[model samples]
Target: MTVQYKFPDNFWWGSAASATQMEGAAHEGGKGENIWDHWYKREPNRFFDGVGPETTSDFYYRYKEDIQRMKEIGHNSFRFSISWARLIPGGEGEVNQEAVNFYNDVINELLKYDIEPFVNLYHFDMPKEQQDKGGFENRDVVALFAEYAKQCFDLFGDRVKMWFTFNEPIVPVEGGYLYDFHYPNIVDAQKAFQVAYHTMLASALAISHFRKLDIKGQIGIILNLTPSYPRSQHPADLKAAHRADLFFNRSFLDPAVLGEFPTELIELLKEYEHLPAYKEEDLTVIKENTVDILGVNYYQPRRVKAKDHVPNPDSPFMPDWFFDNYEMPGRKMNPYRGWEIYEKGIYDIMINLKNNYGNIPSFISENGMGVQDEHRFLKDGRIEDDYRINFIKGHLTWLHKAIEEGCHTKGYHLWTFMDNWSWMNAYKNRYGFYSVNLETQERTAKKSAYWFKEVAENNGF
Candidate 1:
C-alpha cells in the first residue's frame, strides 16, 4: 500500500551544506587555514582520489547562481554554515572584514529571494591553529569556540534567524579520537571522553552567550540521532541497545535538551575511570541554559544486539565493548551509500522527542542518500535521480505521519543542495539535487530537484 504525505502549513523545504564542503576559496578573503587544509597538505592521499577541499563546488564564487537554483527548486529556507577560520583568521585574534562582507552578501541575497538562511557555527572544520594547540582535547578550545560563536552572532544575527552551535558533536569524538577516520586519529577512549566534554561545554557556553546578546534569532544544536533497534526481546539485547543510545545519541541529546548528562553514561565512564575533568561551575552553566530549538538529522537506525564475545583486556576501552551490530536478514538497504534504509526510524525519533524530550519543536535538518559514481544517472541535460526521489518520499511519508500524531517537526532539509566535497569521502558520493561541473562552474538541476520543487510548492507528495 502506498501512503500519501501532505506536509504541514508553512513547513520549510530546502537543503543543507557546510562551508568546507562547498566553499572553495580556502586561501581567499584572508581566510585562516583549517585542519583540512593542513591535513590534506601533509597527506593528499588520505582523501578520496587525492581531492582536497581547496576548491569544492565553488559556492564561494557561485552562490549567486546557486541561490537562484534554490529558488527554482522552491526552497524557502536553506541551512548552511559560516567558516569560523574564514571569519576570523588565527581562530580568535582578529576578525576578517572581507569574510564578514562575503557572508553578509550571501545572507542578504538569500533573504532577497525570500529564502530563510540557517547558519551553523561549526561543521567539522576546526581551525588548524586550534588543532595545533590540541584541538578539542584541551579545555581552552571551548572558550575559543565560544569567542568564535560570539563573533558570528555580532556579524550575521540580524538576518540569520536559525543558528546551530555545532553539527553532530559526537562525530568528532568517535571519528577522530576513538576511530581512525578523521585527523588527530588517536585510539584512546579517555581522550575521546575529554573531547566530547569540551564540545558539550562549548555548546552550552554558546547557548549562554546567545541569551546574553538578546538576539532575535533562535539558537540550537544539530544532532545526528540514530534510533537503536534491539535484536530481540531479551534483556541483554535491550541493555546493549541502551549503551549504544547513551554513547551516540544521548551523549549530546541530554546536555543540549535536558541540561544534564545521562546518568548511565556517567556511571559507565566512572566505572572505567575515564571521566573528563570538569570544573564545579560547568554543570551549573549547562543546566541553566538549554537550546531554543533542535535540529535532528536522521539517516539510519542502529541495529544492535548483545555482544557475543567478551571484551579483551588488551584492546582499548570504548562503546563497542558492550554491544555489537546485528545485521538482520532481508532488511532494505541503500546500496549506493551502503547505509540501511529504515523508513520508520524517522517516526521513532519523533515519538521519542514528543515523549522523552519535552516535545521540543524540531525539524528534519538532514536526511538523504549519497550515491557513489552518480554520473550513471546523468541524462539529457539533467540527472534522472528517481531513486533519490523515492528515498526522500519514503522518509517524508513517515515524517508526515509523525507530525499528524503530534510531533513538533517544522520542516525537511535534504543532505545537500548541490554536489560538494565531503571530508573522507571527498566528492565520491553525490547527494545533491543539482550537479556542478568542476571545470565549467555550471549548475544543472537534476530531475529530483524538479520533483522537490513541486512537493514544496504543494506541500505534499
Candidate 2:
C-alpha cells in the first residue's frame, strides 16, 4: 500500500492515560487519598453507574504486560502521569518507597521496549490533604506543588526526557470552580480565576525548578486547546469568539508558550473585578519560565456567537456573560460523545500557534473518538471500530498538512490505550484502541489498534 500522509521520521505514536483514570490501585501501593477518592467515597451516586476511580484497568499491576502490548502496537512514545498522592502520600513529605519502585519499574519496562516515557506531573488528582488547605488557592500549597514537581524530576528525569508540569491546567478551574463537575465543586468566577492563576503559577515554578536541576530533558505543560470559531464574520460573532478564545485557550497558552498573560484577558478580568489575588513576584516567575515544548489536545472546536440579551447587573460574572455557545447548523457531530468532529480544528490550532506563538515544538497529545456502549461494534471476538480508525485518519491528515506548512508538529497520541474508568462519566464513553472487559480485565485489541500499528510502522496511513 502506498503511504499517502507520511509524517516526519521518528514521530511519536502512542496514547495517554492518567494514573487516576487507568491505575486501579487507587487505595493500594501505599497510595494516599486524592480528591477523586475522597469525592467518590462521599458522592458515589454522582458518578455514572456508581463507578469510581478504584475500578480502573488495573494498570498498577499489569503495566509490564501493557508495555509489551505497546511495543507490539508500534508505539514510539507513551504519555502517563505520575500519581502525586502515590508518590508522596497526602501530597507532602515522606516519599513512599514502594511507589518509587513501581514508577521506576514502569520507566525501565518502557525503555526496554524502546518507548519514550512522557511523564506528566499532575492530572486533576489533587491530594485530598492539599485540598483541605484550599489547594492551589493557597500560595503555600503552590509551593508544595513545586516541591512535588522537583521530587518527580529528581526521581525520573534520568530516564524520562519529556516532562509536563500539568495536563490541561484550565480543566480543574472549569470543573471544580466554575462548572462544579469535579471534586470540591464550587461555582464562583472569583475563585475560578484564582485557581487558574495559581495553576499557571505552579507550572512556571515547576519549570523553574526543572531548569535549575539541569536535567537533560525538555519540560512543558499540556493544554487542551479548542479553537473558538465564530458563527459568522459579523463583528459581534467575531468578538464573542475572541472572548472565548481569550478565556479558554490564550489564558493558559500565552503563559506557557509566550511567558505572559493575554492583555485582553487581564483587562477583562479587571473590568469585572474577577482578577485573581496574586503577588507581583509571581508574574516575574511566570514571565521568565516559559515552556520548551507544548502538548496540544484537540477534541473539538468551540463555536461562539454574541450574547443575545443584556446580562442583569445582579448576575454573577461568568465566561458565558460575554458570549454564547453557537451550534453551527449542520456541523459534523460525534453522536456518541456529543462533541463536534471538525478535523480542521487541529490544523487551525497548529496554524494559530505557528502564526502567534512562535511555532513552538508541539504534538497532538490527546485526540480520539469516544463511543458509548462500544460493544455495539463488536464483531467476532474484537471490536470492529471503523469509526475510530476514520476519526484518527481525518485528524492526522490535517496534522500532516500542518507539518508540511512549517508547523513544528511532532506526534499524535490518542486519549487512551484501553477501556478505563473515566471521571464522573466512568466507563460510559470508551476511547481506547483496546476494548477492555471490566469484569475479566481482558484487553481485546480493537480494529483501530491494528490499523494504528501499520500507520505507526509506516510513519503514516
Q: Write the per-residue lDDT of candidate 2 for residues 146-219, one digit (tens) a residue.
A: 99999999998999999999999989999999888997998889998999999999999999999999999999
**Could you give candidate 1's per-residue lDDT for residues 183-235 as a string of tens digits?**
87789999999999889899999888888999998999999999999999899
> lDDT of model 1 at residue 455?
92
| Model 1: residue 6 alpha-carbon error in angstroms | 2.0
Off by over 4 Å in 1: 1-3
Worst-scoring 10-residue span by lDDT in model 1: 1-10
lDDT of 1 at 163: 93
Clashes of each: 0, 0
lDDT of each: 0.91, 0.94
lDDT of 2: 0.94
lDDT of 1: 0.91
